[model samples]
Target: MRRTVARRLAAVLATTAVVAAGVAMSITNASAATGGVTGYATQNGGTTGGAGGATVRATTGTQINQALCNRASDSTPIIIQVEGTINHGNTTDVSGSSCDVGSTLIDLKGVSNVTIVGVGAGATFDQIGIHIRESSNIILQNLTVKNVKKSGSPLSNGGDAIGMESGVRNVWADHLTLEASGGEAEGYDGLFDMKNDTKYVTLSYSIMRNSERGGLVGSSETDLTNSFITYHHNLYQNLNSRVPLLRGGTAHVYNNHYVGIVESGINSRAGAKAKVDNNYFEDSKDVLGTFYTDERGTWQTSGNILDNVTWSAQGSENYPAGPSMPSTTTVSIPYSYALDNASCVPSIVAKTAGANKGNQVSDGSCNAQSPSQSPSNPTTSPTTGPTDPGTSPTNPPGGTNLSLGAGADGSSKADGTSYGNVIDGNMSTYWSPSGTTGTVSVKWSSAKTIDTVNIREASGTAGNIDNWQLVNHATGAVLASGTGAGVISFTAVSTTKVSFVITSASGTPRVAEFEVYA
Candidate 1:
């Protein structure tokens, strides 16, 4: 039986029930009209059963904390809905009169499956957005958290927009916008912090502007995929930090577009293995800026850097702190075509591996080098002719292109010939009167690019075709020969020869068509 592959899809559910509960609870616990401070709380009704159950309604950070400390472990998820804005006058913005740093907006501990969405449009002047500790399965999606002071006072660590302590897991943070417009010394540190054993987390499709340190910091095993992370995309005029710091775990970083402003695109460390593929990095001063080595003293390694276009790395520097091990510090730019910059060159300098094995720069130019040839064997001609007149013409026709047709066994062909003369069965053999001692002419009309054509002994298994040859049709030279089917490719040129010959075969050889393209 023939084989084929299939595709997979993911699912998304509506938030109607969760939103309805929030609306009903908002009416009963409405705050006072004086615009001072109030308290409200609700829980997510999801059946997945984690810590995503709270909605709080404390205007002041102090009031929000008091409400959270009073909730039972299994009561329900708390939704902290701030009724009105509370402007504390303290500059530290933690626990005083200041709107910036009196108390944290919401502090979550030992919670799971909890989400904190915006209640209304004008929710503003909050303290730190959400502080999470030892939480799992929590989602903080669709909230506009801004004007957060990084540091409360002169001798403290700046408040992060969303801080995840040592034990967070399986967290999904999406569609969040954090604005830290405070001074450089007093601004927030990072938008999202995943440090100390935070595993199986995803930070996707969020925007951050003007953070003092960076955008995101993942210390341990984490997966950061499908995120639009760019300094230029953020509304801030000046970007002063790195995009993401992948410290541990095998991070899969793909499909992200990065434009650096002040630092490199990614700052990986401690022998992290990052699969960075299909990403567009444009005009970045640094790309893959710095990294640490593994326990074996091997520098930070990348899994595969496939199909990434780097516009410029003008101010970028390779790792090793000053390049003591020149071989270890050198970067591999695989499948990258670098233009301008004479020093930068394509990873695959030539068409084959032998041409690029040990050659170096000469006169600032690397010319075409010869590739190795395959082992030679006796060449033979096909012992068979076309099964029908349309495919094999006995008499000479003036410039009429001969085309193969569908075999009698229901195998479709471009030429549409309908006959059973062509052999189409396992262990089947057929021979034509048309034979050449030195060469064989096989013709077919195909719009697709023909790569490697295989001649298989039809009786063998799919992977065990007994007689095969790989011919470069453009150069008209036999490239390689093997035990299985024939493999042919178009070498920057087009051809109509869909046929091959087996000099000798352990069993009767059968022909099949295979095509490859650029």
Candidate 2:
């Protein structure tokens, strides 16, 4: 059956190329928006086909590389909708090494606004995965990348199924099945990795299985500035380490399922903070919060369920301790998103996580466009956290760091001061507007009482916020107004969200801390 399908696919591809030899080829509407990162990366939140652009159906490695290079040279957004198997037989190792030499790899370097989507059953990149570097605004969906083993090549791209590095930003990967033959001995590295200041990426509804290594963010501990990544509704199975071994970035990991983790999962180190929420881990060991090599890491967990987890020895290699629910660090997604209860994760994940052979995905909650949607017909009731996320169950004295792990957003983002940094418990790090004046906001799933708000300015004199007003999201009322980081006191009100709108500033005001306390 496999051989017959391959023969048919090869003949179709040959005919496609021959038919388009002398004529202008146009893309079909295969690049329709599939939600998640693809929607987020676009201005309309709608991904279109390579409209008004050339479309080429690439089957061999050379044809794929040529098509990509042609689109890249124009520096325009394109969609390279792929079909059939693209393997090492058609690719040459551009790494200039002997290991996996003459093997083909899809290297998207220095390109912008490109979408790679699968057509037909699914597009498979065999023996090599896509490598993205120095690029931005890219989307990859409905593809399978496997068997990427680089033997004898010490100078490879870490042999990852999909690797992004060096100023890469605004990427979305969805519905990908990235796998390997065995471990590093089998010549495969991480399934997905981002390093060297990669930011604003979301990996959703993907499957990574049967591999020794999972993934990593920030190649070194000193790579401090790279951050703002999200991992949601992914299935990680039979992995040993680097369940995204984060170094210095902040990651929002939610609704992911971890099964058969041999050694470790979610290795957070080098001052990285992982906001873990509503995930499921079963038949796995050391599922969360392992600090690897050096430097301590921090994680805040809420509504996570663990079952059949056998923890290993907890000392030496594992630093800063295991994954535990801390009092603070309650996360509120600033964007509209969906969640599936841990009890129903297995059922939903089985149908949605991997490549749907014929584009018939029973994606379950993974496709919910609203933040309030819960799993439909869950097998069991959703588990609740020890405390309500935003509300103080004890109602103790002015609850601690209400904004510590809350979801944050801003009118504009500039430099390395992201919206997440405003409430990240680090005054040294800040969130600045691209322009001199803009709004910065924080959100919560539930309402809470808040009376005090503090602002630490990145610039004390110049670039300080001269005039500002705090607005309530629910009532559309102005709560407080002040200038120049004055400690503002307001009547405590229960609200889901609030924002500080800056009317005037001395210069580009950088907010180091936006602390909300109740």
Candidate 3:
């Protein structure tokens, strides 16, 4: 299936090149100098053009590169208006190294105030969509970066599609689409990987899909606010792994939609404070909040609100909420389980109930919920103490647990292969189908480490299952297992489900009782 898709992409790229060749002939270079500032405008010779009434030849990759990169930084921001297709022809092929003839598409180093607009047709690239390094005040708008990956080289460089690295700031990425055209097994890199002290960055109205990693803000404190970074809108599909990993950064993620991710949807790890709110999710294995802290345990989640969010798993909770202080330095809402539309008022009413509630509530707002006040110390004021600014639950409930359960059958599969199993009053037992040979997943009620899982045989006789394995619900790592009837025992991390994958089963195997003892 992956090979078929790659072949189709190659064919499409070839056709696009043929069409682009005819259009490149009539392109005229319009260079203008105003107030001793010289700037060149390239108009598309093709039928489609840009807003600034400029068109350029699309024959050589250097022409596009020069239009975008070679611009005066001191002047009023070089505007490269791209109207038609910017084809980086099939870097998926083994012969190609970078996207085009150059090592990079747009290498902006120590340059500033550059604007690359796609107009209506939307810019398309085969590899390394836009590379920004040590640049500032750049705007990449109305573009689509598709079919980007390292095909020829064994060692793929960072940002196969689009990359921003090393002291880049004040860049706005809007209405962009980055897709890993390679299918699930291809193992491509992320759509966008911004790292190394990249600050004041905003990615909005963009779609990232079908890559090994979706869109990442890593190794630096970056701001990703008001963007739809997910797979549901057909941005990323047929992926075998997670999407959008936030590693070691302070990112504000809000108002996004995530759907049908195989692994962890959004991971906020390595002392990263992720302010998540007002997002909708569906058909996802894991939705949000995998907060990881280093030795300092400085990462925290605050003002991260999840409202009007829906799920597919039966009786599954939204996000586990509570006073969760993994270590002394960092305090976050580890598990917030709330029903749909329960409102922050109910959660606040539930957590701060009675005498403890009265002390924290002042003038209808939560005084204790402020960042300056620790969960252990409610008396501390919001202004005192060294508090993280982009931290706090934006909505109500002060970080409480609420479970809304699965929405519709079209959104999920009832194959009994979840890491956490939510056994509602309707269903008594869940089973994997006969002749199916893969991991079986069961989710738990809450986050708890697993000690043992009891699986009873339901119908078929148990065969020697040396090739079977059990995986953790949250992390998706294989756990230690010993065989007995259908019983498996392993160490637990959180109140997650235990999944069993049958590798070499002779006959149909059935499981009756699946229990996790904490």
lDDT of each: 0.35, 0.63, 0.40
- The predictions' CA RMSDs to the true structure, in order, are 24.8, 16.5, 27.3
Model 1 Cα lDDT, one tens digit per residue, 194-218:
5655554544334554544455545
Error of 3 at 516 (Å): 63
lDDT of 3: 0.40
Best candidate, TM-score: 2
**Model 2, span 407-479: residue lDDT tens:** 9996777766689978887655677766434678889988978887777664333224555667776765667
> Residue by residue across 1-518, what tens digits does model 3's lDDT show?
11233333444344323332332211111111000000000000100011112233333345555554333322223456555555544222211212122444555555565656554444565455567777666656556676654554332344456777777765656456667756434646667777665665555445565555666766433343212122111123333333456665455444344434444456665454555443334334444545232311123333323322333332322231222312223433211111112123222322322211211221122111211211111111112111122222123222212122411111122245322232221123334333222345555466655566545434333332223445554654556532324445455467445555443222234443344455
TM-score of each candidate structure, all chains considered together: 0.41, 0.62, 0.43
- List, in order, the clash count of every candidate structure: 47, 8, 44
C-alpha lDDT of residue 350 in model 2: 54
Task: Mark the 10 consecutive residues where model 1 has the least summed lDDT.
Answer: 34-43
Among all windows of ten consecutive residues in candidate 2, which has the lowest summed lDDT?
Answer: 371-380
Residue runs of model 2 more than 4 Å from their true location after superposition: 1-34, 38-54, 92-103, 152-156, 320-324, 327-333, 357-518
Model 3: residue 405 alpha-carbon error in angstroms: 56
